[model samples]
Target: MDVGQQPAAWHELAATFATIAAALFGLFFVAMALHLDAISTNVTVRARARVSLQSLALSVVQSLLILVPRQPPLWLGIELITTEIVYVMLGAGLRVRAGITALIAAMPIAAGISLIAGHGPGLLLQVPAIIIGVVLGCWQAWNTILPAELQTRRTVTKARR
Candidate 1:
């Protein structure tokens, strides 16, 4: 068991790889179930299905851009635009504030513009993007964790049971 050896030399560990893959698949399925449950009331299952489809399409385009040596410019454009559109739709569906959503929506476009500009994105823009993303993420986490009436209803519901 030489730890420094490459993955290619681990061909004999097919069973271990299979076990890991199975575990990862199970985790992914469980996550999908939780996600579906969380959004079921506000978003219809069919709408969720459409979102998944759109996401899959964008993922394919992104993969091509990353993996292909000669990825088409059109594919990159499609991937970038579709991703932003999907993010915006998801943010609206989840009732996030417009300002926060707008900032999040602009992130990729900002990065793309910077890349196209050839000099690359400055640290100034990157720093703000990171800070904005972290702040918005924390705000959303707090909102989800402490919903209005959650504390009041929880105590009453516990007493009833």
Candidate 2:
């Protein structure tokens, strides 16, 4: 594919990514709703849940941005970088796994920098970023919720003793 020409492949990729991101966001929302009380009552859990939601929202927005016709590569790069920075900042207060969060945060910024520099096919870089973001989002949500659930069960067992 020529550097200057838009790849025909992007359309299908963008559509697929957008759909998946949207679905993941919906699933996360439902999960949050189910655990609303636990999340709201605990400050730590609330922060983690907020970060998780932000991560998913970032992925969904990035996927939709890819679908925009005639979007400037520079603008997309800026958007990606900005969102990553926001994610990192949001996670700053949470007791998340630092290594995983760092890796997840790095992927999108690296991809965005490549896109800004015009290193190679934009989609090639962008697609991985989206995938990583979605995976990270889901992981954060599960990481936040599972331990709380376990703790609740343990407390109930102790009370029964």
**Best candidate, lDDT:** 2
lDDT of 1 by residue, 1-161 (tens): 22211223323342343343344334434444545434344344334333333333333333233333444333433444466676566544245456755665575456444434433441223234334443443343333333323544665689999
Q: How much does candidate 2 score in TM-score?
A: 0.74
Candidate 1 at 94: error in angstroms?
A: 7.0
Per-residue accuracy of model 2 over 65-145 as CA lDDT, tens digit each: 666777777777777788779767865424567776677677667767766776655556667767776777787788778
Query: Candidate 2, which segments miss by more than 4 Å at Cα?
Result: 1-8, 92-95, 147-161
> Which ten contiguous residues of candidate 2 have the minimum total lDDT?
1-10
Poorest 10 consecutive residues by lDDT, candidate 1: 1-10
Pairs that collide in candidate 2 are none
